[model samples]
Target: QEAKLWLPSAVPSVSRLTVCSVPVVETEIKLRQYRCFESLASLRHYLSLWTRIVLAQRAKPRSHHWSTRSQKAFSSVRERADDTAERYRRDRQAILELRGRGDWEQRLQVLRNEDVLSADPGLL
Candidate 1:
């Protein structure tokens, strides 16, 4: 013979495959599947607690409670509130100024002179 090749006479067969469970990973998966709170009361309690915590953090929101995006969102909300307050102030001042004018002042005087208690509100 010029050449010869060696080969196994018997072939090995796999019987069973065993899967090991990781405790930490299994626990984490279970935790994710679990319900957040048992009852509505507990949910409400935690919400109130979180509200208090958030309120406490409002003064200086540089803590872990606030992320950069959340801080920016709160800042925008604050800015909108300030803008609304300023607008309301300006509107009230304008209304007051308008009421101090001739016809409006006369009408207010007439209403004041009349019996407000007995006066028909619809006509006024």
Candidate 2:
């Protein structure tokens, strides 16, 4: 009788497996190459360059005219908002008027109850 042992010959290390299995596309490689910033100025320059490129792409003014229905809807919404604001202001003013009147009436009632002014008809 003979004892035999079978062992796997190719055992890939974690690092090697991860590195080889993932496909690195050209765009990713280019991005990785550009990611090295030696200083803050370099990073700022890179960002500004990209910003200018993006801005240049959108240099043309786009004409965006709203549809008639949309314009009407927006106008209605604005009118509704204005009306609500006006109503709020009017209600607030009315409430303040009522409060002022109530305070004035209370003071008048107190004065009348004390009969301080009634004693002197000249003060009335």
Best-fitting candidate, scored by TM-score: 1
- 3-86 per-residue lDDT for model 2 (tens digits): 773111122333433443333323332332233212223423433443443343356433454344444554454454344334
Error of 1 at 97 (Å): 0.7
lDDT of 2: 0.34
Q: Return the clash pairs for model 1, or none.
A: none
Worst 10 residues of 1 by lDDT: 7-16
> Residue 80 of candidate 2: its Cα lDDT?
46
Instruction: List the lowest-lDDT window of 10 residues for candidate 2.
Output: 110-119
Q: What are the lDDT figures for the candidates, one per model?
A: 0.35, 0.34
- The C-alpha stretches of model 2 lying farther than 4 A from their native spots are 1-66, 101-124
- Backbone clashes, each candidate: 0, 0
Top model number, lDDT? 1
* RMSD score of candidate 1 (Å): 32.5
